[model samples]
Target: MDDSVRALRAQYGGTLPGPVEALPAPHRRDLAAVLDQARSRQQRELQESTDASLAALPKPLRALIRKALGL
Candidate 1:
């Protein structure tokens, strides 16, 4: 399978819509790149929020929270 197909399927929980899967490879690759970037940005924002929310706690408790949540 094309890497673009693989990336897109992974994003969609292991399935791609038929129309998307039928797109030319170049278009699929472009779509995958755009999605990957958007996912990355969202992840970064979430991480920042998680860190900020935990910042007020004492060090040991923060460590415990991070470990408990696998953050």
Candidate 2:
């Protein structure tokens, strides 16, 4: 599979369905773009949540937590 298809599969969390695999290159690329956008948004949201969670911790403990967790 080409990069676009591989990326699409990866974004889909692996092993794309048969229907998706059967789509034409252009449509697959479009789907891949959509999935990429969704993944990016999810990652951004997760990072924001993590930062907020960390910020809620006591300042003195925050550094120790980050170091212990390798964040």
Per-prediction tally of clashes? 0, 0
- In candidate 2, what are the lDDT values of residues 23-67, reduced to their tens digit? 988899998898788888999998899889999999999989889
Give lDDT: candidate 1, residue 67: 89
Give the 10-residue window scoring lowest on summed lDDT in candidate 1: 7-16
lDDT of 1 by residue, 1-71 (tens): 88999989998787899999999999999999999899999999999999998998888899899989997
The TM-scores of all predictions, comma-separated, are 0.75, 0.77
Question: Candidate 1 regions off by >4 Å?
Answer: 58-60
The window of 10 residues in a row where model 2 has the poorest summed lDDT is 2-11
**How much does each candidate deviate from the true structure in C-alpha RMSD?**
2.0, 2.0
Task: Highest lDDT: give the candidate number.
Answer: 1
